[model samples]
Target: MGAAYEGLSEKTRTRRFLASVLHLTETMLDHLVDDVDGVDHVALALVGVGDDRVGVPTAIAR
Candidate 1:
């Protein structure tokens, strides 16, 4: 017989995961704004978490 799945609380886990995703998204947005105006002091620079961090920098050519 398969393990009991009835004890798993899907709703709670889903809410927690969504909250975490929202927080990370907000952090990215804050970093974006800081990089744009370049008029404020930012504690954490925008850097990738893993092996994908190294890449070419982009500039808004206008």
Candidate 2:
């Protein structure tokens, strides 16, 4: 999430977050992660596929 957040453009981040969010603290990330309860909510991480079968997450959805 740190990587993804850093990758977000300033405009994109502001529009998505509805504010001028410079960055998310580790505590904030933890809260975001913990907010998902399997029964009610979930997050999906999208990644590129490669022949080596290793990839970095490109996007995530909640």
Candidate 3:
């Protein structure tokens, strides 16, 4: 993935990968929050966005 994204400018590549991962991650979390009983997502904290992946805190809730 890093090799594939190397052709893109640094800023665009970072944004594109982060957006893709975040979309997939948010979709999974949405499903979990919706299917499980008494479950709620409080916040999403993104610590960093790397070339191949993103660093984000997992779902937190009461």
Candidate number of the best lDDT: 2
Name the weakest run of 10 consecutive residues (lDDT summed) in model 2.
31-40
Over 4 Å off, model 2: 1-9, 22-31
For model 1 the local lDDT of residue 25 reads 48
Compared with the true structure, model 1 gives a TM-score of 0.19
Question: How would you encode candidate 3's per-residue C-alpha lDDT over 1-62 as one tens digit per residue?
Answer: 33444566667756755553322354554664454444443433446557879765653433
Ranked by lDDT from best down, the candidates are: 2, 3, 1
| Candidate 1 off by > 4 Å | 1-24, 35-62
Q: How far is 31's C-alpha from truth in model 1 (Å)?
A: 0.0
Greater-TM-score candidate between 1 and 2: 2
lDDT digits (tens) for residues 1-62 of candidate 1: 01222243666435644542322344554554445553454343443355776754343221
Model 1 backbone overlap count: 0
TM-score-best of 1 and 3:
3
Note the residue pairs that clash in candidate 1.
Answer: none
Clashing residue pairs in candidate 3 are: none
- Expressed as tens digits, the lDDT of each residue in 1-62 for candidate 2 is 88898799999989878898988999988868888887687888999978999997899888
Give the candidate order by descending TM-score. 2, 3, 1
TM-score of 2: 0.53
